[model samples]
Target: MKNLDYAYLGPPGTFSEQAISAYCSKYGGKTHACDSIRDIVETIVKDEVDLGLLPLENSLEGSVNLSLDLLYKHSELKLYREIVLPIAHYLLAAPGVKKEDIKKIYSHPQAIAQSGDYINRHLSEAKIVYTDSTAAAAAEALKHDDRAVIGSIRLADIYQLDVLAENLQGDLPNATRFVLAAKADKDFSDKNHLGNNAESQFKTSIICAPEVNRAGVLHEMLGEFAKKEIDLSRIESRPTRQRLGEYLFYIDLMGSSEDPDLIEALNEVEAMSGYFRLLGSYPKTVIK
Candidate 1:
């Protein structure tokens, strides 16, 4: 078997690292750590690595905007597979500290957002500090006495922080969906078999900007999918970053891009929209 090199977001002990390790373990491959998701994607694009794993969305936090923005801006990479790992957040602190001693909570913005209700109820007087990653926040908490960090339990162990609490996020079935991406020509069909079966389910994503003053433009876009009975899975709008009121629409549908109905929908969308891009067709992540 050929050896594979994989890149994931890390200083280590991140949920991304855990997900990457789980995927690589089945294939006996080594995983490399990257500073950011963009770096991971760029590593694959430059042939510095064989694959890249990146978080796409979380069940509690909705879409990861940076990942979507990066995907929208980078056209050289392709989505090869996806994995959904159950999320279990922990509150970690230095060994001598107790849960009641914590005066502030720190974690990645997504983590903080996911655990909002819990934080509001139990740590109402605590301040929230957003860090780059859960692991990073935990590392910082290790050097402070009054701070607690929300992150993976594995991170607390790795950093030698005590677990003040477990499963801090109230979402019982919380999970994060990650994408496996590679350069345009890399074959992923084999790994597809090794990954989560949920990764094998078909899904297509596209981005578009509708023309202004075109009455029923949104309706027309939906009509293409509805006319063919194609189910729309998600639709989100993000600012174009060009100007106020100018926005781009990201759409996910339940079918492969190559499916006849999907192809026809894209064709019609291309004719009706000002600009459009097909993100990729890949398997959907199964939420547990």
Candidate 2:
């Protein structure tokens, strides 16, 4: 394997950054930390780096819509790898500051959502302040004794903040799914066939928009998969933003795109869909 240049969402200490760190620990790479997921996606789309990593979904916080939207819009970028990182949230405050001394709480929105129960019960009086990243929240916390942040334990030492409380996510075993993306410009005759192998477990993601605004179209679309005996792992809807009721469907098929059955099924579905996109066909990484 080559030494890849990776981009991630961060100012360091974010789960996205941590995910890339874990991924590259065995195979070293330089990481470019972007301020947002869109930046990371765009960087990959533009081929500014060898790869990009993004937090796609969370066990507690749900799907990251920005990631989905960017992927849908950038059909040239392929999701080649996935990393499921075990995430744990912690509460940090300035040195010598106790939890009761904190009057305001700052963190990324997903961090806030994941710690909802703990915040409601323990820091109900604290004002909730959201930041772009958990590391940014920790950066903000360093300036105020009355402020606290909910983030990873890795952030405490980075900003010289004290761990006001450990595992503040209500003892839940939280995890985030991150995807590795790269440009899909290689031809099939090229070596590795764009990173494909017979032994790899694969997942193909696609975006579907119905051609006509009619009833039972979604059911009919799904029937195409069922009739072909394709197993869908996930299905999510996203607003196309053209109208109030109009939406786009995202689905993950539980097999490789190279499979003849999948190719046949997709060919039929594509004809009926107003717009359809094959985001990627890549190997699935299962983390222990």
Which model scores highest in TM-score?
A: 2
Tens digit of per-residue lDDT, candidate 1, span 119-150: 88889899998888888788889888999999
**What's the distance in Å from true for residue 285, model 1?**
4.7
Q: What is the TM-score of each candidate against the true structure?
A: 0.82, 0.83
**Whole-model lDDT, model 2:** 0.79
Candidate 2 ranges with C-alpha deviation above 4 Å:
59-63, 171-173, 186-200, 241-245, 286-288
lDDT of 2 by residue, 73-178 (tens): 7778777776778778989988999988999999988789889999998999999999878898999998988999999877886788888777777666577887
